[model samples]
Target: MTDKKTALVISAHAADFVWRAGGAIALHQELGYDVTVACLSFGERGESAKLWKQDGMTIERVKEARREEAQAAADALGVRDIRFLDLGDYPLRLDREAQDRVVDIIREVQPKWMMSHSKWDPYNTDHMNTTQFALECRMIAQAWGHNPGQKVLGAPQMYLFEPHQTEQMGWKPDTFLDITPVWEKKKAAIHCMQGQEHLWEFYTNVARNRANHFRRNSGGMAGGRKAEYAEGFESIFPQTVDELA
Candidate 1:
């Protein structure tokens, strides 16, 4: 477990943090990282059908419920803060102003690492746009002239978390984090999304499959251990020491 690092995950929708990178988020928190989640929207229009199906569930009510759910998940993982940009859900469009706002958050947080949805997720337009926006913010934060009221922090290590359907989405797992110890925590966090309970088993299976892939490749004694879970990440840049130095 790496100690006392800061991690930020920017997601296109509130539930995305749970569905995609919950394991990684839990592991970071368990390792004493000051984790934060920035959700672009509550996913009211797209992902909240279950919530809205309840009698008299207004859009505002759905959003409020989702916000509470997200916060609970973050708290369960020991996250320090959660921010929601409240942009419109579904077909997310990253306009100039939205990009600037994201960039400002990056500069303010100065995270050691940033995680977001993969840009190539074909099933979700919002996911792709969020990825593009996050990448743009990363570049802007590190650029020479753009100032967002804070010292220009160097670019944080950027990682793309696996999309919901990895193989279909062309999400190859280039890096895997052994999140075995925090698997339960991850599950608990995901359980906070009451609206998504039906999909829990499928996602759990996905994590197990990723763990097996890492075990086969890494070839360590711990690799043979069963009941392990993993999270996959694709680095936006080479993880060379010079890059960080």
Candidate 2:
């Protein structure tokens, strides 16, 4: 791996990182790589089910709670740079300006690897839209005239993460990352999302199952490792020797 390489995970909601790629973030940080999280929404709508059931749980209150949760999770993984785009929840809309903003962030961060939700997810409208925007922004950011600030950045490798309902959502995992050493850290990160405990549990199991799949593929190394966990991803661009080496 390259020194000072950065991994940027852009999500539709603040807590999406916890469910999708928390272990990957921890592993990157553990290996001395720079990791950043960019959230398009605070997840004010979808995550408020628990709090809304309680007394006085307004949308603003839910947003604040999610902010705190995301902060704590990021802190646990030693991540300092976190950005929330404040896009609407449920159905995330990315207009021209919103796309430009994403490009600008990519220009500034200049990450080597960028991860976002899979566009093929059928269940969540927000996830699919955000994924499409992220992919388009990545392309625009890499282009010469489209993003002037992106000059310093090499073309980034983009990966789409599995959604919560991978099988039901039709998310096919083409690549699996080993997160065995950072599984504990990933769990700790996930614990920060108090608003979505029920939802997070499902993802935790998904990670374990994906780890098992990797284990089987790796000739049982994944299963043999007790604390193993994995994140699945699908790549849009084919990785070349120059990108990896």
Give the lowest summed-lDDT range of ten residues in model 1: 219-228
lDDT of 2 by residue, 59-138 (tens): 88888888899999998877878988888788777889889888888877789899998877677788888888888888
List, residue by residue over 1-245, the lDDT tens digit for candidate 1. Answer: 33346878999999898878888888877777877899999988899889878998898998899999998988877787899889878777678888888888877777899999887877888998888888878888887688645667575788899887777877666888888888888888889998778878888888888898778768757555554788788888766665542
Backbone clashes in model 1, listed as residue pairs = none
TM-score of each: 0.91, 0.90
> How good is model 2 by TM-score?
0.90
- Show where candidate 1 strays beyond 4 Å: 1-4, 220-227, 241-245
Cα lDDT of candidate 1 equals: 0.83
